[model samples]
Target chain A: GAGVSQSPRYKVAKRGQDVALRCDPISGHVSLFWYQQALGQGPEFLTYFQNEAQLDKSGLPSDRFFAERPEGSVSTLKIQRTQQEDSAVYLCASSFDRSSYEQYFGPGTRLTVT
Target chain B: AQSVTQLDSHVSVSEGTPVLLRCNYSSSYSPSLFWYVQHPNKGLQLLLKYTSAATLVKGINGFEAEFKKSETSFHLTKPSAHMSDAAEYFCVVRGPYSGGYNKLIFGAGTRLAVHP
Candidate 1:
């Protein structure tokens, strides 16, 4: 069985540009989440998805952040007008169900805004 | 609301010695506690989880944690430290969120270093 996976393990972007991070959750996972990890800090929640619906986006720092999981299996987090403060590791996780406690995580995409 | 605190920013121990990583949590409801390990350039791996099934939870790689509601603690421990154990450990708590889903809140994390 395969675990969650993320693409572009590392990304370097210039300020004012837009960047997109991809996440492939385990097959049949009913819940998906995104988090951000800054240097020497714990991961902070960003957004969540249940099936094809974006259930929560309150954690998104600003309107510049957008996420989509149209098909319900894969997700993408897009940041518009990237800023230095947005530089961090973007982590994606998935669970068997919304009630399940165990969340399998991906390797994450480390974004650097220069 | 739920939050976790890793008592120590870092802990260093010699190989073969006992290891302890302390964590405390605050939550409005019954919390689901977990310990996750992260190696350099790797994904977060679940070490163990406490979902009220047991007070003492055993996880992979001979690691375990005890959930104490009175102390509000779920500390991770290993009988003997191994050099391979050097990495970052996080204490996480899952609590109710909007839409009937649980949100995971993580601690700042503890960096453990094992020296031989």
Candidate 2:
């Protein structure tokens, strides 16, 4: 009955540092996704995970962005050498199956790169 | 590629008045449409969805949306809006070209305000 959850609801990082955001998908959810939204902009796709497999990463802005879903249930989005432009609300969502097109979103991690 | 467009950046209405939030979508194939609402400091919540099942889809909190293929629209509406309806609304679309994943493309959200 629990919904998707993200950790460090707010994170502040200095430029050139590294930061990792965590997502805990709903119980038994097989599909996971990550999104980023800048001020006054809609959310943009970042990556997707089917179980433990990283299916799509095309939306990742640069090589500095990396994601992993090692055990298929939890995921992490890591940004290396964080830049000021990376500041935004990082959202995570999960669905039950491939056909479960409706995704349940988390509170989102508000990341600030100073 | 699939995309969504929100017609308005903001919508305001008095309590008990009809609510309308317009949205347009683009997809190469039959699209699956959805409406999501987000309260400040909270997660996004699904209001309703329209697959191939019906032209008009009803969702929670007395909200509904009509899917018009010809107009490329899936606008959300309610017979009477409550003060609590004030929030940010998003229109999303999932096209048929997904490679085993449901990539929901979202529109610029519309901020709704309700007045007493």
Which pairs clash (backbone N, Cα, C closer than 3 Å) in model 2?
none
lDDT of 1 by residue, A1-114 (tens): 999999999999999999999999999999999999999999999999999999899899999999999999999999999999999999999999988878999999999999
Question: Candidate 2 chain A: minimum summed lDDT over ten consecutive residues — where?
Answer: A95-104
All models: lDDT? 0.95, 0.92
lDDT of 2: 0.92
Please give, for residues B1-116, the per-residue lDDT of candidate 1 as tens digits: 68999999999999999999999999888889999999999999999999989899999999999999999999999999999999999999995767968778999999999998
Model 1: residues >4 Å from true position, as ranges?
none
Chain B TM-score in candidate 1, rounded to 2 decimals?
A: 0.97
DockQ for each candidate?
A: 0.89, 0.79
Fraction of the native A-B contacts that model 2 recovers: 0.69
Model 1 Cα shift for residue B83 (angstroms): 1.2
- Once superposed on the true structure, which residue ranges of model 2 sit more than 4 Å away at CA? none
How many residue pairs clash per model?
0, 0
